[model samples]
Target: MLPEVPTEGRIPFLDLTIPIHWENHAILMFGIWFVLVPFAIMVVRFGKGKPTTYGIPRGTPKWAFPEVCWALHFYGLYTAILLALAGAGFAMLLTGGFSGSLHAWFGVGTIGLGVLQIISAQFRGSHGGRKAPTSDPDDRTTWGGDHFDMTPQRWWFEAWHKTAGYFALFLAGGAVATGLSQFWVLGIAIALAVVVIGGLITAVVLQGRGYNHDTYLSVYGTHPDHPFNRRRFAQMLEEKDRKP
Candidate 1:
């Protein structure tokens, strides 16, 4: 039987009438975003680099396809799990509606953006070029006899998916900061420190090995028009020779 305080004037810092249930929600949110999401991203980022450990040459685009597919599959599964946890947390918040509060709405927005990210992934298929094909069962290549065609729709989906991910991270940080503006000083500090350290490590690893999507594109092809596409390299070379 919590006190019936109306959602309107219950800003976490200003109101200072925190209930146990709200505190529970804050802890749940923190754990899901700070710990779980980052860990999943780290695993996908770093795990993709480990194909070299299994004898696949580093920076070889064709060899990396299977690893990239597996990484996306793992991330998609992780996103679904995070959505479920976020849904449960939001359900608890709805018991006493979070009307007119930045923290609540920001949290809701993060969840929505995350859902969009998952949907975007469903459309991520590799635009294929006519290259040497392998018979590996693990390779789920999107390329076929399309004559070096680049699917703009798939590229747009990937771009939006990445944009939504960045927004989700920003909203999660804002929600956590506002939610704990005036309470649990020590716990919040420790939790933030952990998150920052983990983030730095992930950044270093991603920078060292390279971002997965960009690396794949660089090795594969930007599009049929771009000079980087393998199909165009020979054409560019011939044009260069003819110029002088």
Candidate 2:
């Protein structure tokens, strides 16, 4: 089990070079971005593999973007744009343009972006928990949706979620690095810890479910709905071969 966090007090080993004055805001933003956002992504990626997993339908495009590919491309793009704008403000602050007005604008804008991240993550997770009919109009499959699972949907879905989890390291690493340099390391630390903890938990859960990496890859080796794709199909075949 993960160690129980003591209270809301400061974490140990705060030796990173950040100033404590801006601690709360920095940590708060990092939490929403690093933890909340990726959790939504994992939910969408993993739960959407089946028609009724989580709550999304079999054909739901929970993990898809623009009704086509991975949803990350869409949200990540929007997030990058917002952060770039914030970075511009940061540059202004760093380069003699930080008037009281400028500081107010950038600070408010940064917090607003953080708020947006949390909201978007919430919406994404909610989308994954969809227990709706497959034939619903909204259940239309896009390109990626079509590829969601033809074979053992759960197997590939787990792989996809884990891959996404690994990919998160890059974004979280950058958040930590940039935040630390700007004297806001606590935020990144929290975000990184969340990512690590979440991934390990999911991995353990999958093992409990009797999934291993090789079995996972084989399920998605080609069309998703083949022999390895459908658990029911595999079990039924096994039953059929047994003599009466």
- Listed per candidate, the RMSD to the true structure in angstroms reads 8.2, 13.8
User: In candidate 1, how many Å is residue 126 off?
Assistant: 6.1
Q: What tens-digit string does per-residue lDDT give for candidate 1 at 154-223?
A: 5577578667776887888887886666344457668887888878986887777656544344334444
Per-residue lDDT for 13 in model 1?
33
TM-score of 2: 0.36
lDDT of 2 by residue, 168-231 (tens): 4455455445545555455466657767787779957865674442322321233334333465
Worst 10 residues of 1 by lDDT: 49-58
Steric clash count of candidate 1: 0
lDDT of 2 at 146: 21
Instruction: List ranges where model 2 is wrong by over 4 Å.
Output: 1-25, 49-168, 181-191, 206-244
Q: Which candidate is the best by lDDT?
A: 1
Q: Give lDDT per model, in order.
A: 0.56, 0.44
| Count of backbone collisions in candidate 2 | 11
